[model samples]
Target: MRRLLLFLLFMVTTGAIAVFSVQNATAVSLRFLAWQSIQLPLGVLLVLVAVLALWIPYIASAGR
Candidate 1:
């Protein structure tokens, strides 16, 4: 229950940030592995990173 509420709060905050970024800028860009990419919003990136962090422990454990 608490976890669900926290997740919902995070989603709402990320959505708000995305909307704000879109309204203020033409687009956001990101660079990775010597490659350049665009299209995804900052809010989406934030959420993705958060999810990746959450999965890191499980992924590391699976290696064993």
Candidate 2:
């Protein structure tokens, strides 16, 4: 039952991302302090950030 719930949650999150990407298909740029980034699709940028956010915590805990 727990595995099934997790699977459903994963499916919902993926579907949300897909819908968000399709609706927000626009070019965007990032700037922080003196640094700047090249233009990328908004959805791509968001997905990258999401992946990094999830990965960073996993990596940190694994090192301990």
Highest lDDT model number: 2
In candidate 2, stretches whose alpha carbon ends up further than 4 angstroms from where it belongs are none
lDDT score, candidate 2: 0.93
lDDT of 2 by residue, 6-64 (tens): 99999999899989999999999989999988999988998998899989999999999
RMSD of 1: 3.8
TM-score, every prediction: 0.50, 0.87
RMSD of each: 3.8, 1.1
Pairs with steric clashes in candidate 2: none
lDDT of 1 by residue, 1-64 (tens): 9999999998998788778656665456778889987677666666577789889999999999
Which lDDT value does model 1 have at 63? Answer: 100
